[model samples]
Target: MASDSDRLRALKAFDNTKAGVKGLVDTGITTIPSIFHHPLPLHRLHADQEHHFTIPVIDLAAAMGATTTTTAPSERAELVATVKAAVETVGFFQVVNHGVPKAVMSEMLAALQGFHEETVEAKAPYYSRDSRRRVRYQSNFNLFRSPAATWHDTLFMETAPEPTPPEEIPPACRTIVPEYTRLVQQLGRTLLELLSEALGLHRGHLEEDAACLEGLAGHYYPSCPEPHLTLGTTAHSDPCFLTVVLQNAVGGLQVLVDGLQEDDKKKSDAVWVDVPVVAGALVVNVGDFLQLVSNGKFKSVEHRVVAKSVGPRVSVACFFRPQGAATSTRVLQPIVTNGEARYRSTTMAELVRRYRAKGLYGSSLLQHLSL
Candidate 1:
């Protein structure tokens, strides 16, 4: 058996290569590296049951009409209600006709795939372990700390509170990434407005007053030689206020949802349900920060992507949260209604710190924060 030091050495060797999982695949390796092997039992890793549950899909056109201005108050209210129910229950929903062009989404995915598939030399400049870099590429963000590595690479762009400088972006994704972030940011703000109204606050409460920022992560999951032994992404809930995901038709995203009857809330048991692919649709999910602010009125459900033997699967996620939380003194408190708060107040920095320490595939950060 490989000792701890041997495993650490293997991890460092992979990290030092700077080429991500795609690079490993490029080498025509027939088996996955030991570091990527998950310790999860076989039964859990290879569950054969089929899940029939489908997440709700919202038609933004029917809800918002041509514009927010033209939409009837009743229609807008209905949309808010739908948003409220989805967030409170599964914490996930899909939206279609949300204003971003299909061409742009396709271009963003293709550009990201192109960036990941480029020659190692071409992508080496953008590869780094420095979190300070607004734009950087890496095989795994939590490579050294996580229990096991996943079969993917990511190019992260800090696009919100401040847009990443165009020159810093990889050449393959330069134009489309910025354009995609801009559109996604607009959509995120609109979603925040709806959420604010759902929380019984004014429309501008979350977007303007709370001041949510945006970040983008383009994830490339290369085909795995041993898909059953690992994952594309381990189970984890987004630590931000919200996440908007754009995925291609080659889908493997799954959300862990309740298997028992809705009324049997006390006897909760989660089952992995596939998030069906809808052409031109974006997935929206509540995040830990949002759930914190809502005082548990909303949930931040666990979700993950499974590794596949098929070719590469790509996704772009836009996260809306606070900016510079680590240095800022701003405190995030629950939106108290009907008297009690379910969680104690904490800064985004502190919350994020706890999350980083706990890592993924463990109990949620919410447990420790609960009052």
Candidate 2:
């Protein structure tokens, strides 16, 4: 295994090259930093920099009681209450018995891994960072601007609103995970509706407001031979409304929680373990926009990825964001009139545009929405 300094130097070299920004797409080198010469330091989320975050785990079975879809008003209310608590407190939760089959999830993961392990030439075409394309892969968002680079490769696929045809997906894993994407997209829509209800908005309110919906199936493959020196993904927040992540069994995913001392910078116990899979559950997390829209009732917490010494880690993160030329200017209805005002009105387009201009820096989107 290469030392942290060695990995950082190589990544630094990659950052200097145009091909590095293009990631493995251009050079066809799975080990990105090798194209360059300098290794880059991993973005470590220490205790001092961490925040308080505890994701909720909700049971879909509660919603589907003996009453069925025509359940009485009170029963429905109870369901809504549980969902509301999950959204408001943790801004994330897992849904078990969500109706999507376990076989589908397993197949999806297998297909994703197979795709990542294919010959570099086979995956080169999808390597650009241009957000307009439904699918693309790149090393890191800060490719062009950041001081250093992260150690990971990604395969992004957008399938929503209009499902990306099965033919468009790579042939390597297509046969095995043929219907997996479609099933997850359906689940994404259902979850979005639930989020709408949780926000006290009319059912489908968020969906309609978001206009066209898009998703990115992010396949994060860890760096081999030198895991401890780098990261699969750096500490950052998603730019979309919500994200559904499917983590592989390797388990290096950790959420930074409260435990920091006022004067100390590193908090040993600040990081907490996130329960991976609970039989059948889709890990749902609120994004920056949702936090703003909900007036802080919901949160968009910061999380980071760490590299491991064991076998490679695989995670599929599906981001749900607005699309098309829909006016981004959606006025935020006040959530709290009393006590210091929390947020200001903003548009979906504006937020995304700003995020794009900034190029995924560590800055919080919430800062831009201050009253």
Candidate 3:
């Protein structure tokens, strides 16, 4: 085991490289560095149980009124019901025909992949730890704080509340980023509307009233030489209101779900289920704050990406949260619930502060915030 000081030095050295995991791969090292090694409990399921579950998939054409002049009341209601069931039970689902052009999605994914694959010199200029920078690239946002590092590098861009200026975007993906985010913002609004109705509130409640902002992260997980020793992403739940993700076919994403059988009474009977790659589908998952504001009616389940030996895996995730959450003084509580509030009322800033303190992969934030 490395001493504390030795590990810190290793972490700082890795960070200084600014080349990210891909840079390490470029050296053709057959073993991952000690910094990227994670502890066990990778949450492997029994072979028989691995393929037994899959997350729900929803078609949003009717809800978005894409095919007809107007969505029928029944069709809209059905859409909301599906969203409600998915959020409440699994907290994750995939959407097909969500109105973003498939071409645009492909372009964005390719552009991001291109950016990550660029020469280290090309990407180095954007490598930064400063949170204020709208566009930044780094290996792990919580590298020093986490118990172990993951095997991915991310190019994170804050695109909403204030859209990232096109000129500031990296040349590889600049043109497509704006277009992709615009369409995603529209899709996000529609989903929030459905979520609002699912909560038995006005259709415009989440989007128009609560007001959510957007943050995009383009994650590049290099092929891990020692896949079993590390994770592509640690098991963690998004802290925002919701997360929308687009992943390429090279899949490794998984969601941890309750696997308890009626005869089984153990509370720890949970399994890691693979989130299969669905062509032209975007994955959506509820986040911690959404679960809190819904008074525990909606679930915010933990999910993670497994490190794989196959090849580079690419995905883009867009996180939505209350606007000005980092510094806002506004307090948020459950909108309307039949029972007592499951979580204490708190401001986004405070919630975020606590989340950062715990780092990703910490115990459930909702449990700590419970009333």
Candidate 4:
């Protein structure tokens, strides 16, 4: 067992540097430091043969495009069914023709990479843990509480309730993040509408019921010499209502299908399915808030990223939820057909507070809220 003093001492040392995992890697350490090693017993997960499974892919151009309001009923219904199926089974899917230009996506990624790959001295000023600061860089949100630190550093920006003042963001990263946020916020609204319909609710239900605040977090994973010792991200569900993640082609994402993990549950499913990189597609997942509101109807499964010999695994994720406590406080409306709320009504702020207070080592935010 790691002694409290030792862990605390190491944690503070790392945090004090504000350099994140990439900084440690720059030191050319051959072995992973104890802080990055998995705290529990390590189980080597089996990857299903590529041909054995496929992640659901949806093209939203026609269905969610400008013509959506006038789109043919059959076309819209088919799209809804497809999204609903993906959410029920895996809680995730890839979306193409989502209206965000490929050029925009590529440029945004390049910008993020440039920011993370810059010298430690250059990036240090933006590193912060203060929630009040909208644009900041940090290693792990729960670095102190988590059993081990993940092998990634991140740039986080809160863009929904209000975007970080342009002057506050790193000048080099300023342009892309705000623009990407606007684009994704629009895309996110369209997705929320689709989800509302998929849940058999009024089209505006989610947008109106859930607050529309959005947050974007860019994760930068550096190549690890001892890749097996640390993860890019640990297994956990998103705490928000919806999440859209954009990743570069250096694929390493894997979603957990509950029944597959022998330790997690029964053996109906047997392995993790690779989420392949499809050019110009965004990965979308139903989140904990959605699952809680839907009374367990929608899925919000755990997912993780593995460190690789590859140089960097860059992914930017947008999380959509209420803008503040006031909006988030509204009790979730029961499904009209079901007429019973599974979990007590709570605000997004409450859920988010619980999430921020706890680390990824315990039960999921959704599970913690279950009746």
Candidate 5:
């Protein structure tokens, strides 16, 4: 437990230093993981940890028609089966043949690295903890109600139809990422269709419900001089309907799976792999909202980012959320009813509000609401 005096001292120290003040200005906190009783050590994913994450490769080209025409029933059925299996078993998978080009991915990664490596002064203006803004740069989760701080610096940007203009994007990254976002938005729609089918619903069912979508680019810059003492991102699950993440060659992202010891966990061994850009291969996964809507039939799995000793790692995560203004408040029909009390209906706005209020805290917003 950290005493009030200890917290004050840390705050003073941070307030005194230029870097610390910069961090505070960007993150809106004097000292992160605030001094508290029983403040836990920062969570880190080590290779030795008894956790293994499964990596599934989903072929998106197979799910959608090569042309714009409707996919054949047999093809759709096969695609559904693959998605259902992947979601049920691993909860996280890699989608290849996803239509986003390799060139686009390469360019995006380069741009992100350029942005992070730029002078601290160049990146400082965007450094506010204001989530209301579509773009910002900061360290750790702004709503980090947790006791320990995550060890990473991040630049977050929201991209969708109603996107933050290119001018707002960091000068280094603006040009490369806009086109990437456009392609991803298209891919997101296609993946939603596959997820709907996997859930035993008609195509476009989920998309119709998710009338609009949002995308975020999480640029993870590792600790330079000392990387071992810190982490890139902490263990958590995506809060939206789906998250499409692109990882750089330097791989430290790991998904936690069932473990051996009473408290042991498993981690996947594969390095960074391409998330397919093909139609219907959006690497969809269950988010907290979807878990509630599906009554837990679909799972939102926990994932974490680990720091690398060699090079900085970057990943772009695009979240697809339901349109707050236009969509219905009720859960989709297929996820509920069926003569079973699997789940109760909840409004998207309420869920989003709760999630915003309680970033990555205990259990989940859905779990708390159910209680």
Candidate 6:
């Protein structure tokens, strides 16, 4: 292992470049930097991923209807059942023909590509580390805190409670931002209501109880020269209530779904499964807060992005977090119980603060809060 002082110096040098992992790759790094090398446990499970099952893909076109009429009660109920099984077993599923237009998705992706592929000079003004900024681009927010950095850059901005001012959003993807935000916001509400019904509660329970629709964060994972040596994102779980992800066809996303049998869990190798990209579909995952709020009724499984020697991968994630005083003050209540409360009641703000402080290292804040 390199000396601490040397690692610190190397880290500072990389940060000063302000070019992110893409910058390093542009310089022709055949071997990944020491700072990007992943730990053994981080990579071990990925080796023998002999997955027999594909993730569940649900079609909601029937329920959405032609004229935007209310879904029939039976259709809604069936949809709820489909979603509940997927969440309980895999903690994720892809919804197709869910009302978002294909044209809108295409434009949003083009916008992401436009911004990330721009010259460093053009993108530099928005590169910042402060989460408070309405719009900023940067790499590895937990670079100083985590054991190693991942090979990805993110453009995080708030789109709900209030949209980020137009001037602040990067121009390359700016034109479609409003429409993308509007559609995803509608989708978030639809999913929350479905999830609420899945838990055997009224459709509005999750929305009224948790700030289920809040903001969006988008990431760009460019090709890595040393793909084997680093990860695009480490194994981690989302901290919010839900994440609606729009990803291009390049496909690097994976989720850890345990085998139901005890022998499966005992095996040293992981049960990580690939989540393939389907056109015009959004991948939804139950988050840590939702698991906590439901007292574990909905699963919050760990997921990660892998480094690839391909071209850029673009994905936009809409995080439906709690808003306003409810964000910090609301207590998590379980409408559907598994047994006793496995975790103590705490505010979303504290949980999120701790979650952010930990970074996306794959270590869950939920376990820490467990009784």
lDDT of each: 0.85, 0.62, 0.85, 0.81, 0.62, 0.81
Off by over 4 Å in 1: 46-52, 62-69, 209-211, 262-268, 325-327
lDDT of each residue in 1-371, candidate 4, tens digit only: 67989999999999999888888888987788888888445524435663244689999965655574678888888888998988987898999999789999998899898888888888888898888777889999899888788889999888756677888877667888878888888888888888889988878888875546467788999888887777888878888888899999999998876444434344565356789999999999888888887788889888888888787899999888766555555665335356566666676677777888886667787665556
RMSD of 4: 2.9
lDDT, residue 351, model 5: 70
Clashing residue pairs for model 6: 211-322, 235-362
How well does candidate 3 match the true structure in TM-score terms? 0.94
Q: What ordering of candidates by TM-score runs from best to worst?
A: 3, 1, 6, 4, 5, 2
**Cα RMSD to native, each candidate?**
2.1, 5.9, 2.2, 2.9, 5.8, 2.5
- State every prediction's TM-score relative to the real structure: 0.94, 0.77, 0.94, 0.92, 0.79, 0.93
- Candidate 5: what lDDT? 0.62
For residues 1-371, what per-residue lDDT tens digits would candidate 2 score against the true structure? 66767766665555344232333443544443442222443354233424444456776654432344566667666767877787665556777766568887777787777767666567767666687676666667555555445556677766655666778767765565437655655666667666777767776777755423466565655544455455555556677778877777776665544455556565545454354555556787878877776777777766666665454567778777765545355544435534765777777677777776776446787786778
In model 2, where is the ten-residue run with the lowest total lDDT?
A: 17-26
Kindly state the number of residue pairs that clash in model 3. 0
**357: Cα error in model 2, Å:** 3.1
- For candidate 5, lDDT tens digit of each residue in 1-371? 56756766764454333232124334543333442222234453354443333467777776543543565667767877887787765577778788888888888878887776666678768877677777887765542354544555667887644678888998888887778877777777777787777777877778866535576766665533334544556556776777788877676666655444434444334232222233223345567766666567677777666655546666777777754343335444326645564555667666776766666545566655552
Candidate 1 TM-score, C-alpha based: 0.94
Which scores higher on TM-score, 2 or 3? 3
Candidate 1 lDDT over 16-51, as tens digits, reads 999989989999999999899987662155432554
lDDT of 4 at 295: 80
